[model samples]
Each structure stands twice: as structure tokens, then as C-alpha cells.
Target: MTRHPGTNRTAQCVVCGRAFPLPKLRKIGQLRPGLHEMIAAEVADCGAESLICDEDLAHYRRRYVEKLLAEERGELSELDRQVLDSFEKGVSTVQSSAASVLDRNPTFGERTADRVASFGGSWTFILFFMGVLFAWMALNVSGLFAVPFDPYPFILLNLVLSCLAALQAPVIMMSQRRQEEKDRRRAENDYMINLRAELEIRQLHEKIDHQMAHQWERLAELQQIQIDLLERRGDTQRG
Candidate 1:
């Protein structure tokens, strides 16, 4: 209700008791009843004429969201905390890219594993290895050299294949583990985005409802004023 001594352009915030431009302040009467009650619970002396700055209103809005989340979920996860923090900070919860969640500087071993996994799963690797196997068997069985290095049964080739399988299995597994981590991070990012959107929608509904209620109150006041004016005119005529 209070303003700066020399200017009517500013109003005092009930919560902070600081003067702010009227455009930056909101009257308590215009707020949704639930939010108004929340403010009243905290600020005992605040009334319909009290004004709250945008910053204070946003703080209360955050608290209201937190309360709603707590009532529904009982306990908040790290993801929820992250979403709430970003909401309060007025920042987007989205990542720049899906891969942005991955470590920027992967270790040499991890990089090598990923490369090996990528190549091993490709059709080129399968066809190239098939040709190599055919050539090795043909050279050994057809006596192409004086004494084939791999001989008839190709024991050396078997050993080579065994070692490749052993090494490739672990490398592919490492790569898969990294991929699983990336998927988990992507899921978390999605969850945060959805939660923020839901909260924003809820806030929008609250604002719309409050606006409609305020309009109704204004219409009612106008009707009452018209009735009083008509009563006064009738009385004056009778007199």
C-alpha cells in the first residue's frame, strides 16, 4: 500500500518492505487464493492491499512447487533437485546435445575400445575377416608353401581367433557399458524437461484461474456501484 515519498509510481513489497516500480509489483488481491494464503501464512500482517515484488512472488511460486512435489513424491531424487534448482534459477533444463552428457575427454583405453567395437560390428569387418580365413585355410591345405606356417589343422589360426575373441569381447563390453551410461543420462535429461513443462503448465493454469476470478470480482463491483447510483437517484427524486 505504501509508495515512495515523492513518487506514486512505486509500491512497497509486503514481504521485503522495499519500494519497487508499480509495474514490477503485484497486488495480493489479484493472486490465486491458495498462493495468497501461502503468503499470508508467512507474512501475518499482509492483506488484500499489500503488494509483492516480482522477485518475492517468484520465490513463493518456487516454494509452492516444492510443496506440491513433496506431497506427491514423498522424497525427491537428485534429478528432482536438479530440476528444482534450474527452475528457481530461471534456466533451461535441456542439454545442448544428447552426447553432451558424455565425458569430454575419454581415456585412451575407452576410445580404443569404442573404435574396436564400432569396427567389429560392421559388415566390412565381417567380410574382410571371412576373406582372410578362407585365404589362410586354402594356403595351408593346398601346400602353397614348402611348409605352411599354420599346417593342416591350422592350430596357429585357432589360437589367433581365440585371442581375438577374448580381447574383442571385453572391448565390446566396455563400449556397451559406456553406451548404457549415455542412455541413462539421456533419460534423466528427458525426465527433467518433462517435469519442468508440467510445472510450467500448472503455473499457467493458476494464473488463468486467478485472472478470471479477478474479472468476476470487478464485474460484481461494477454491478454493486450501479445499484447504489440508482438507489441514490430514486431517493433524490422522491425527496
Candidate 2:
């Protein structure tokens, strides 16, 4: 509901670059350089970057940073050292917070069972088998409504049915095997995402541990220096 650049403006997602008609989760977005300036310049006498939606911000960030930028650094004013330092600190803090969240987070993979289920359902498969059986029975039975389409006892009908099943079974099996392969691929992608997340978490903890160890080492060094200085002063006074 709240607006940013204009009275009725919707913010584009900094992460995904898609615009929202209504305000979205603000924490997910960041201001890309020149985004506002280009929006202001839109449809002028010259070319300008078009406004985008929040849903697309990530894609834009990945694909169109250069095209949108009017200059090498993306047509933005040079950031002062203080601004840069503050930005870096903010980023580090956000990353640390994300790491903390990820450490405690549980990840469950998106289910690939839907694809497997799509191969066919048990009900449908059974229905198909029932249809085949009913057709065979009707053709063999001599009745007023029945035609001799399959003839008496339906020997030829059974032979044809057997041949059809023999052919179709292998194809259905192939389809199922292909589905299994796709499921394996999906599982692998899930594994990779999980692996990357774990690595990122591990790296964060290692960094924090290293910083703590470094601080301890520095404290120890300072204590040793103080002791040395005190001993030197005492020796001079004694002499």
C-alpha cells in the first residue's frame, strides 16, 4: 500500500526486479543503481530503462544489469568511503544474520512424486484393464446385442490382446524407467541445493570461530608485551 519513488509507486524487488501492485516483504529488496533515475527518464526524448516488477528483479539482476545502466558503474553517483564502508558493514551483518537463520533452518526437498504419479494412476490403469476384459467377453459371448467381432471363444481376440499387451508392457516400462531417471535428476538438484546451503553455513561458523581465535591471540600478545615492558622497567631501576 505504501509508495516509494512516487505517490502511487510500487517498488520493484531488488532481488527479483519484479514490481508489486502492493507493497511486498521489504527485506527482500535492495535498490539497484540507476533504477530510479532511469524510471524518471522513461519515454523521454532518449532511451531509458523501463520500470519492472518485483517478481523479475532477480532475473534482471542476473541478465540485464548492463543494459539498464547508462554508464559503467550504472549511472549512479560515486559513493563516498563512509557510505561504502557502511554498506559493506550492512551487507556483512545481513549475511551473518542469514547464516544464523540457515543454521537453525530445516530443509525439506520439493516432492518429485507428482511427476511419478503423472505416469498414470492405479485407478486409470485398472480401468483400462477392465475395458480390455469387457471387450473380450462381449466379443466371445453370442447374444442378441453382441456381434461376432472377435468370434466364438475369442481365441483370436485373446491372441490379439496378448500381442497388444506384449507390445504395450515394454513401452509402459520404458516410460516408467524414464520417469525414474527424471526423479533421480530432481533428487540430485535438491541434493545440490542442500549441499550448497550446508557449505554456506559451515563457512559462516568457521569465519566466526576464526575471528574469535584471532581476538584471543591478540589478547595473549598484548599481555606478553606488557609483561616484557614491566620486566625491562624493573631491570633499569635495579641497575
Clashes found in each candidate (C-alpha, N, C closer than 3 A): 0, 13
Error of 1 at 97 (Å): 11
- lDDT by residue (1-239, candidate 2, tens digit) is 22256765665433344566544423311233333344334323222223345444333332233342234445533222222232323322123223343345333311233333444457876788789888677756847454666667678877987997786566566656655765665554454445334434644665576567768989999999999999999999999
Which tens-of-lDDT digit does each residue in 1-239 have in candidate 1? 45655656777899999988888998887888888899999996799988999889888877878888999999889888778877877888884344465747888998998999999999999999999999999999897799889897889999999999998999999999998989888888889999999988988899998889888989999999999999999999999
Model 2: weakest 10-residue lDDT segment is 79-88
Instruction: State TM-scores per candidate.
Output: 0.87, 0.39
Q: Against the true structure, whose lDDT is highest?
A: 1
* Model 1: CA > 4 A from native: 95-100, 103-107, 230-239
